[model samples]
Target: MSTLIVPKLDEQPWPTLGPQIAAFIEERAIFGPGSLKGQPARLDADKKAALYRLYEVYPQGHPLQGRRRFKRGSISWRKGLAKTEFMAWVAFAELHPEGPVRCDGFDAHGRPVGRPVNDPYIPMLAVTAEQVEELAYGALSVMCAEGPDAEFFDVSLERIIRLDEYGRADGKAVPLSNNPGARDGARTTFQCFDEPHRLYLPRAKSAHETMVANLEKRVLEDPWGLYVGTAGELGQESIAEGIHEEALAIDRGEIDDPQLFHFHREAGGTYDMSQREQVIEAVREATGPVGEYGPGQFESIAKQWERPSADKAMLERLWLNRWVRSGQQAFDPNAWANNGLPGSIPDGALVTAGFDGARYRDSTAIVITEVSSGRQELWALWERPADVDEWELPLDELRESMAYLFEVMDVWRLYCDPFFLEETVAAWQGRWPKKVYEWRTNVASTVVHAVRAYREAIASGEVHWSQGDPQAADLARHIGAAGRRRTNFVDDDGQPMFMLQKIHPDRKFDAAMAGLLSWEARRDAISSGVTRSRSSKMLVF
Candidate 1:
């Protein structure tokens, strides 16, 4: 409400079952896992409006008509809001026999109708066991154990089983602190996390992602996930923050993620926390009716801000719901996004190319840059398919792509990693001579300066790509995943040196590595006075 920093989805055109889902929640779920323990649940105006967007479905004539729009989403708000209680409402709807959650078909009026996910598997995950008991799992258990729907479910402290007609368990909502894969291969239809901001541990992250990977198994169920949390601590690289970055990219229009819905609301502008009125007003905007500033409310959350040891940054993150940047990221996602210059390098353009190859367990990529303008494009990338076990780089097709590039354009240089591409690089060098040179990243002694210069190029917009290009998303993802690694070394410029490495071990950045090498090749082309004319030779290794 306070000038929504990241706005919610539009309110009009209730072309979704979101409203129906909201109705189902208000009628079925209860108000408290906290203060109003046995009260009938009432979703406030703000909370009710969110369901409309979150439950949008694809319309007729669309590729997957009548299917729900979002496959995953995040809702970020200030502290003290009943986010876990809201998630519990959704969890009930996900598994309740009569709850309208999955899109069934169109109504006569052309709007989407909904049905419950069949045999739904819902996992409520948290960072620790105490947190598991303290959050959404707790809220859900209270709802099932104490609410009107209590007879429909067999509830326990850790699990809720929806009873079938014969009084047997038909669906389950389980609480897990580790990977759900270990349980029953994780057929996660609709999973919820209380606060991914606190889930920075490697084990928790890995576990949650396993459930995500398992979402595809129940494709007919229209599987999805809802993560509700606030801003994360800086430098932690929390899951919420990662999704927050993805949300920002979606907002910027630099990338498209059609199946993701992220709602981030925070009060805008700075405030003097010492001014009681100003602080209360900001809190009021963030909390709305839940602000508790009125008389007889008894419990005031604002006292925490006045504590002597209160950290202003922590206060801004938790209370104001502001995003804080991490220092470990090698490139700023915003800057990289802004550099979407819009157009691919044309045929017959003078170019410098970089090739980074891996035989297996990673991606092999080639990126090319137009020398005259520094515009870059992903030429090709070979990645291992998950379903394929006996996979390797398609050398035959790779050679065809390489040969065709030289056939169509004036390639100034190809700085290639000769690791798995040793035979290919040798053949390329034999044919192109001075045009091909080996760039081994592991030899940090020489390539560190080149790496530093390429980083500078991206920062200053010396290199850019078209947002409209099909490869922009891949490039953006690789760029975002890249992190600065300490080299315990220095470059020729007498500054500390670093290398770009994957922030998550599970993520790959071969395309970004190829782009860096491409820019470095262009730098040396300029230094050696290489021209577009074929009469001159490039820098030889």
Candidate 2:
């Protein structure tokens, strides 16, 4: 929460339509202008106008059907496909609609609260003319279909309001570091992460972190965090991949009670390569082979969008959004989604804690996994000094939290970042230290531990979550795409010391980092691990 600072409401401009679109949106969705008392359809004037314009402007061959998934390669037909524009517009409708939709709320401490505010609205975040309109319409349609009872709240205040040019409220982007009265006039709701794939890089990732953190803080716990985007790039890394992984999990049911919405052109069918030669030979005899085309051509055409042009394997893993396995990793989301949360932990088990620290203005997280019961609980409980205050606090507070966790919760051990608060930690140890064991992680060590812990938890059937908790689910998603650094550091004896490097340039799972530290600490703390049932209830302070 600290390193990932949420900009104030005034930081960005409100999502306002042009004069014509604005008029249309107001007329269709909200109440009609002037003497007109009532209107047809399920919408008010603003809803109607916005939805009408959106439906009217969608381009031919574009994917508009809210079926299982839209066909890909449709963008290729248009000269200048404006997906971003459409998405932006969709985001606007979701946030600014006259009625309500499902949304989350948060307290000043950033803890989630209340039943989700489910309103009948869909928001998009498009960036082009046609896209803006089409996306707007698609979102509105979804809203209308949901009817009056369906409503959701949002955490994104800025996206809800109208913005001027320069990505600012009044044409000037406010400096997040210096602006006051930022969130004065913004709206809030169940947050949507539109087009996550577009932000694959570090800068994009950071922006996403900022946005998501802001929303999380605002929406509180159990709010729906919807992510809509195509798969881009592969590798076990990237935020898009994370979304894809979660969708896969929801599809498979590894996470319980997950409401998954995904659409892909290539998911409906499959092809057999073994019959290719014979089919190709027949095709060759028929059409003279069309140069090098054969039975494989059919398969390729069918799967064109299933993978990307760069890094076929990676693309398959990422864009195709399929599970990419290298070894005997357990808990395939596809498989688990079908099975439900693994009965890994026995009921009434002993649990340990894992904590990850953050640098800059990031969150501090604590993850508890019941060793016997297999129940897993993760909380990004604490925020950084910068998140709440202008400057950073040196060390006293962190040490106090750490000590409290160690003593009160029977937290066997702690996994933590050495660099984030290295000096502060030193100060803590110097002033009033416990003989507590610790694992200081670097990027490389963090990755190893991450893979080990995740694989072990899933493979061992020891990881379970609270059903129907999007907050925990979102944390899981964030953990999925977290990558690690290449090299790590060592101590005086050349022993692996800490995970100092970053996973992605922009994105780092501070929560995951804390989890890693906790995992490592558990190993160091216990002699013979206690039975899972013996672990006490989750401790929260």
Candidate 3:
């Protein structure tokens, strides 16, 4: 099966304490809330191999000899692969009094030996309160309560506190709540974020960031993070996808590696979705031995995929562990992730611009794309504050940003939606009469045609985002929230035309619209032999 094992193995592998740690886990850990609710927990061969990789350390007497080589370890397996349960055991090793979770000294054969951390403070965090009872925390609860090592701790639904000779609390494992107060967990020795894809809520994301920063405080413990989950929906600006991108950057050598090891597995073999047997084989390949024992896991997934109402895209993403976005998302998350090049366009470089305007409830954006390199940058964006009803679109700032773009870059064309700003557009047109045009997004034919061209440009590597800009994350959110919206028009080949739409009514994709307009402007400029402008840079407004 095709797998993504980052930082490809060295000619000689590093020594690890994984075997002893694994033995401890199997002896003390019990199954979490699942089909094997109270059964002894076991790791399949594939998962055990991944565990060895996670624990691989530097050699015996180096400066950081016993410290873990990978401070952050991730396993991206298919659904039904027991990823949550597998990670829960790692948490157990961290929290248990007898667990050999930390490395102390090297063995006679040069293998790292392990020991328990003193006064461990481990938190198994779930994105929401409801998920705490179903995910990693839940599994941990079961293992501590029902396992052979029940005598080692005082287990309760609230928390698991390890006991010493006098029954005093030595270390503890708790399910952190998703509240503002619960996020200040600075005493953490090891933190686990369960199904971080669901961790997109503002408070949840904040909690994660806060917890990550806390990992530095307990340096002596050699603190680490363990993340395990199935593939998540590609967009939604998920925490999972963010880490995935970081691993990719490390793989590309664009950034210094922070000892992150990502084990990403997908069904490897080619298959026809139409063939039922082939579909089952792909599912089996992805799930490995985990699917073998699950109650009808492989057959059930295949049936779901064959259902008339099923989301084939989502099924492919979840069951096959592919990164392609599901739910008719307008842009490919992989494509967008791969296309962000690190640089900025020089001032006076020719570029095309697009504008999408909105009033109080929504957002406004102006995206610019360089004529020569096809790099798009989020020049400006404005959003209304949720608590403030007395807000405006800040047209003055919008106009100023546009003027800056014009003065800095030789804008060849400016395509703008005049909605809620017809007078402003008129004034700008009057100033740069030859360079600006009033492009109405309400026109189905023109808008759809332009949107298709923009999508094609993005997919074909003809357009990309600049990584140097901190505002790229904001633009990524706007782009990620966009799904498909069917238009009344069709393409020249007779396929139905589509425009970007919000996956939810409350979500904002205005930057995507602005990007589409900018790309459309670029398309027109490229066709008319007007890719660049040598005119003197000036903006009257």
Candidate 4:
């Protein structure tokens, strides 16, 4: 393997807490029940580097001294890399009397150490109770089973309590499921969110959001937490991906929140799985020391690849830790990623706007396309608030945004999907009779062609977008979440047609539909010879 492809750490001052933690792990912890069972838990170079970065404390004269540097962090690696084992060790360290202390200074060997907090409570949380039992509790239980560490800590299936008789410095580690009652009074000093990619489901998402919100309330008491997981399949909208995006934003200097430390180790990009050597190399890079701990990972991957009933996309996501689209995805996510540029349409440029509105369950979005350059922009998007039950669309705000778009840009055509916005569309059509049109997306014939044409534009690199726009990012997600659904009906030429449908019922695809409508309107305007300087007078109302 080439060392050039590996990630390099940035320069930082001295006094990192990694060495002390490493010493504790090597001395106290043992390998779980696997190929390396009973062996001392020792980290490799990559993992050790990640640990040092995660526990790095600012220098004494720095502005944020004496504070836990990273309030939230993540370790995204491939499967079978002992991610759960690492998390289990960290959980033990957190609950122990000497874990997670405020750094005072460095020792003779330049090892950072500090004083522990009083009354520490660390929780290992997961989306499902079964997963909590298997990944978090299972690993910790094995580590603290029959060793010197087991005598010092009372390890049980439910929780581990420190047996030390210290002065008001008691601590414990507990396994927590996705329940309001379990997370009710968790004033956590350190918390671990294991396998957060499973939170992509709706029910899991609800629990995960509530748990994270509750955890954030106690940040003042304990600002240190870890989000550890592998890369999820595309369109899942995993909370892990959300944190990963935030870390990328911070790294690019797009946002200024420095308390989030992200350590991601995956294959550089997509690999041609057809080539055996390429697949092996990618898997080897992703699974650092899995062979030493749990052999047969590569063999298992090869078996899965050769199996007739295996899902290739899912295997790529699980084994390679790459974000891959579903098998039925309507568009290639990589092609969409390539078309993102770093500019937006100039103000007052001729444009076509598309509006997609939903009432209670889904989202409402506006997508605008520049007539000349084929550049698409996400104008606005609104989703139902999680706290409300009977949430309604903010039509007034939508109307105001629409008016602002019309006033600022010379809109050639405004196509509105008249789903729950019949009245709004009618008003707009009356106001801008020459420009506004009620576009019905429910018609199979229109939708089939529109979806085909829009995807073709994206595939051909004709659709350009502003890079790093959060709304655009959301659009890409929604597009990825859409699956191609073929209909029984055929076109005039006897060719089968299809439409893009949501992969999951709760996941929204309104933004993608709005983009399609915008592209359709832009095409129509171009065919009708509509130019930027077309001086058509509107009647004053």
lDDT of each: 0.77, 0.38, 0.79, 0.73
Cα lDDT over the full model 2: 0.38
Give the alpha carbon lDDT tens digit for every residue of 1-541 in model 1: 2433233355555378878888888888887566688888888766776677788787877888888778887888887677877888888888798899888888788978888778888988898777887788888888888888888899887688999888998899988886645754877789887899988888888887787887788898989999998878645768887787666656656455456777777765456678766776666666655556357232244566678887766776787776653455677665677687766787887899999868866788889988878888888888764335677888899999999999887898899988977988999999999889998988877666777777788788778886557877778767766777778787556777888776755456888889888988988777777646443333333
Q: What ranking of all candidate models by lDDT puts the best one first?
A: 3, 1, 4, 2
lDDT of 3 by residue, 217-320 (tens): 88899888888776676556677777776665566564565678888888867777888888989888877655576577677778887788988977887889
Give the number of the best model, judged by TM-score: 4
What are the models' TM-scores?
0.66, 0.40, 0.67, 0.72
Which candidate number would show the highest lDDT if scored against the true structure? 3
* Candidate 4: tens digits of C-alpha lDDT, residues 303-369: 6677778788777767877766666677777788789888788787888999886877678999999
* Candidate 2: stretches off by over 4 Å: 1-230, 234-349, 383-408, 420-435, 443-456, 459-462, 466-471, 487-506, 524-529, 532-541
lDDT of 2 by residue, 1-541 (tens): 0010011112432222123334333333321112322232222232233223222211223352111111111110000122322333333343443322211233454322222123322233333223323443334333333323123322232222223233333111111211113432323233344445444556545544544444434332222334444444435355556655454544544555333333322221232323544333322222221223233553453353334453433433332233343322222333222222533433333457665665445566667655434455554354443214444533455567666554455443344455666765565456434533345553454555555555455545454564534456544544543443333655456744333233333333565555445454445434454432234443232
Name the weakest run of 10 consecutive residues (lDDT summed) in model 3.
532-541
For model 3, what is the error of residue 343's alpha carbon versus the real structure, in angstroms, after optimal superposition? 28
Error of 2 at 37 (Å): 44
